[model samples]
Structures are given as C-alpha cells and as structure tokens.
Target: MPKIRQVEIKSCRLETYSSKICVPLPAQNLPELLSVAQKLKELTPDLIEWRADYFSASDPKEIIAALEKLRAVIGDLPLIFTYRDYAEGGFVNLNLELRAAIIESVLKTGLIDLVDLEWQTKVQVREQLLQVARENKVSVILSYHDFQQTPANESIINILKAQQEAGADLAKIAVMPQQRYDVLRFMETVLYFNTHYAEIPVVAISMSPLGMISRMAGSLFGSAITFAVYGKESAPGQIPIEKLRPLLNLMSSP
Candidate 1:
C-alpha cells in the first residue's frame, strides 16, 4: 500500500489514516455557541465543527460575527464550517442558491480552517464556491450523506472518488445502515480507497445506533476523522465527545 498523507491545520495535526475526534457545535445563538465552545475546550477535541445551518439568524453578517466569537474562544483549534441542507437531515431549510451564497461568504472570512460542502450541490455553483475557498487558503471537505440507507460498496466508492475529482482536500460520506453487513461494506470501501488513493483524507461514517462501532473503530479501517457530540447530536448516531475521546485514544494507541 502507498503511504497516507496527513492534513495540518494551525497547531493541530490530523495523522494519516488515523482517528481524530470532531465535536459539532449546534448552538442557535451567539451566547449558546460560545458556551459550547468553552466547554468543549476542556474535552480537547481534535477538531470543532460549527453547524451553521442550525443558527436562527440567516444573515451572513450575523453568522460571521458568531464565527469570530467562536474563533476567539477556540484559539488555534481547527474549525470546520458546515451548512448542511435540509435534504441531508439538517435542521434548517434553505434554497440551493442561498446555501451556495452563504458558503461563499463564509469562506471569504478566513476565520475557518476547513469548509464542508455537499457533494450534491449544483456543478457550476459548487465550482464557484470551491474557487473562492481556494483563493482564501481554506481546505474543502466534500461530503455526501444518506440518512435513509447505505448503498452498495461500488456506489460508496464512486462517491468518494467523485469528491476527490471535484477538488476536495478531504472527502466525507455518512450513511445509515440497515444491517451489520452494510457497516462492514462501508469500512471495507474506506480501507480500499485509503490503501490505494492516499492523497486526500477520507471520513467514513455509518450512522444510527446499529453502526456505532464504525465510529469507534474508524482508524482501523482508514477513516481519518469521526464526529462526536457534546450536548446535542448533529447526526443520528454520534457518540458524545467526552465518552468517545478515551475510546478513540485507546483504539488508536500503538
């Protein structure tokens, strides 16, 4: 197998093909957002994800102001900006054009280290947003989520490849598993991709309670990042960061 590559952001280093815990902040207001960030700092998550879509304010200025406050509290910790659409189990409902504009505006702020863009976004709009992100020196994490069911291994692999081809610095896929084999297939696909294509980081998640093991054991199968919750779960199957941190450390230890 080829050697895997690591992604560095600020003082944090995400080691190649290893597990890094990410805590999602789903606050609806600035006060709540700062409170969450302050608390998670003690837990020591490798990355902090701001679920911007959940914020009650839709104005870009308000969102940026909130992010600035979040950055102040977190300091040098890597921050990922995610504005998930409603179709992908996100709380907020936004039109495609509006969503693209919001992401573009956020990328220009330079406060975030990584930005998460949905793989299903319109091609022209996606390219435009990616260009802006690149101009600002921000890494892009192209993501695909299936809240319904996990697809076949071939389909999963295709999605990962598509993200890489579309200029993503990291590729992420999260699927709901109906059976144990579905989770296994997801892991197998990730392992194959990481072993063969090591240029970009891959984040593979199998959602729902049945797939919790996938979250904990991601490092063994080449998943570079795993999402954990602190107070509220941004996704269906997230383990709390406090509990997940120790488990990930134990599993990833040499």
Candidate 2:
C-alpha cells in the first residue's frame, strides 16, 4: 500500500505517525475571524482548520477573502478547509454541488494544505474532489463521522481500509461512543489499522464526553492528526487547543 510521503509545512514535518494538533476556527464573522487568526498565529498550531460552514455565506468571494486573510497571517503553515454539510453534522445549507465548487475555488488559491473530503459523498463528487486537490497539490483527508452509535469493530476497520484505497493522504474516522465498551472498540480498530496498514495514517476518534480519553490518548495507538478547538468547538467533545496541547504532548512523550 502507498503511504503519504513525508511532507513539511512551515517547519512541521509529517513523518510516519507524527501528531498534528489542529485548532478549529469557527467564527461566524469575517472581521472577527481575523482577530482569531492572529491569536492562532501566536499559538503557532501544527495545523489550522476552517469550518467554512460557520460563515454567514458560502460565496466564492467570501471564501477567497477568508483564505487570503488566513494565508497572510498563517504564512506557510498548513490549513485544512472543511464546510461540513448539515447531514454530516455541519451548518452549511448549500447543495452538495455548490459546496464542491466552493472547495474547488479554495483549492485554486493554493492557500490550504489539505481539504477534508467526507467519505459519505457521492462517488462522482469524491472523484472530482480528488482531481481538484491533485491538480492543486493539496492533500485530501477522506473522513468518516458517525455521530450516532459506534459501528462494530469490523465495520470501522473496513472503512479505514476503503478510505486508504480511495487515494486519500490520510483517513479520519470519528464515532460517538455510547459506553465504555464502545470506546474500547474504537481504539481496537485504531491499533489494528495502524499496525497492519503502515501506509496511510489513521485518525480514529470518539465523540461525546465518554470519548474524551481517545482524543488525548490517540497518539499512543497511532493516530496522526487530532482535532482541537480554538474558540468554539465544532463537535460535541472537542477539547480546547490550549488544554489539548499539554495533554496530547504528555501522551506523545516516550
């Protein structure tokens, strides 16, 4: 299996299973976003992800303006563009095609380092997204999210395997654990995928309060990228970057 070639952004090198600490920027106002961006620059997060769905509008002009501001402040740091749809637990109201167009425009700017493409999208849409990202040299993170009950262990592992085969630089699976057993099952899949499939880096996480430990302990089992909120959390159980930074660092230590 093919793996993501080690790549460097700013000074961060993604080698093997290095942890990427991302701070989600979810401001609803553009001007307010700039202030938050400045703060994020000060923190110098490993990656900055924009929940474009949080914006008041999804127009290309608005997207361009936002990316430009991020590029200006972020310099060469990596940025991940994600406008999650309502069905997939996002606030965006546009049709899927319009969303894809917005992402295509963002890719053309050469501003973002990666784009979070949902695994649940139509096959045609996924193909087009892969093409756009490839042409722009942006990495595509094929993501799967189950806000409901956690799927069985076999199902989760198959999803990761399928995502890797789908030409993704990284694979992300987020599930909501209903109980302690659910959390253990989620981690078991992470460990199996990480050990058996050395090519793609797997991001396995559980949501809700019961799933908090997975966020802090992911690095131990082989999760490469972990999401941390900067201002407001886009998900149910996201720990703030400030708090997550220390905890994740402690966990990553040998």
Candidate 3:
C-alpha cells in the first residue's frame, strides 16, 4: 500500500485515511454569497467550496474580488475554488481555453486553499494549469463527475489512479447512481483505491437522492471529504450542512 497523506487547512487536518465535511457556496451574487458564507460559518464546516461557475460575473477580476470578500467572511476556514465545466454539471459552457484561463487566474489570486480541476481537460492545457498551481502552492483536486450514470468499479478505480498520476493532491469522483447497488459499488471503489492503490486523499460520492447514504457513510470507506449544501446544492443529493454535521457526528461517535 502507498503511504497515506494528510492535508492541513486552518484548524482541520484531512487525513487520507479519514473524513470531513465541505460545504458548497452556490450563490450567484454578492449579498447572497455573503449570506451563505455567514450562515455556513455558524454551521462550522471543515471546508468551504466556492462554485465559481455559479456566479453571474464572468470577469476574472470580479471573481477575484468576490473571493476576497468570501475569504474575509470565512476567516481561517479552507476555501476551494472550483469553476466546473458545463459538460460536467456546471451551469455555463465556455471555450475550453477560456475555462483553463479562468482557473489559472483564480490560482494567481493566492486566496484559495485548493482548486478543483476536471480530469478531462486536455493534457497540454491541464499540465500548464497544474504548473501554475504548483508555483503558487495551491493544492489541486482533480475531479470527474458523471451526472447520468455510474461506471463499473474498475473504471472508477482507473479514474482515481489517473488523478494520482496527474499529481493531484486529492482525487474526487461523483457519479449519479440509478440503483442502490451502484452506490455500494462506488463506495467499494473508494475503499479499494484508498486501501490498495494511491495514498492521495479521495472524495467519492454517488449523486441524487438514491445515493444519499454514500454522502454520510463515505468516511467509513476511506473518502476524505464530502460536500454539503447551505442553501442551493452545487450538485444533486447534497445534504444541508446543518443536518449533515449532526448526522456525521452522531454516526462517528462510539
């Protein structure tokens, strides 16, 4: 087995062998954004993920300013900057180069703790952005999202291994499961990879209401971080942070 890695952000430590909660900020405007941040602060999530693709402003400067404001409100909490591509459940469709540029710009701001990069980005472009992220010391979460259906366990393991090979600090896979067995398969894949393959942290979830249990039970299977929603969910089947926090605590207790 590979050596397990641990990521420290603020007061929390995300061990490759452990689990934590991350809340997604899906607001589209300044007031709504700040409101979500303040409310999430009260809930005390382990990390804050700003789904930048959801914001109305497309300008890089405006996005940076908004992130700065978010940093002020969430003080010391880790922030994840994500500009998801529309092909993978995000709201907007931009030119691939434009999307890559936006991510590079966000990394330049130096305000975020991590950045989510899609695993499907072209190798040349992806490498360039990864280089920029490395220079800035920003951790990358190379992710794959399947909004329609879950793939076989072997395929999922390949995806995680690909992320590890690409030098991602964490690997995340989210799939929409059509049945209960798919959820189990997804968790099993997570367990297999974290136990037998790469040591990088993994965030695995099966989406939609049918896969809700995986979100709460992922920790048991070696998923390091799970996403929760405050108001609007960035992805399907995300539990509200308020409810998820207590449930996780209850489930984790002896």
The lDDT per prediction is: 0.88, 0.83, 0.87
List, residue by residue over 1-254, the lDDT tens digit for candidate 3: 77878877668888754569999998889899999899888888899999888899888889889888999999999999999899988878888977887889989988998999999888898899899999998988999989889998899999999999889999999999999999888888888888899778898889999999888886688878988887788888999877887878876777
User: Which whole-number lDDT from 0 to 100 does residue 124 have in model 3?
Assistant: 92
| Model 2 CA deviation exceeding 4 Å by range | 1-7
| C-alpha-based local distance difference test score of model 3 | 0.87
Model 3: lDDT of residue 140: 88
- How much lDDT does candidate 1 score? 0.88
Q: Estimate each model's TM-score.
A: 0.96, 0.94, 0.96
Best by lDDT: 1
Cα displacement (Å) at residue 139, model 3: 0.7
Whichever of 1 and 2 has more TM-score, that candidate is 1
Tens digit of lDDT per residue, candidate 2, span 139-237?
A: 888999998989988898889989988998888899999899999888877787777765767777889889988888877776777788887888888
**Poorest stretch of ten by lDDT in candidate 3:** 10-19
Preferred candidate (lDDT higher): 1 or 2? 1
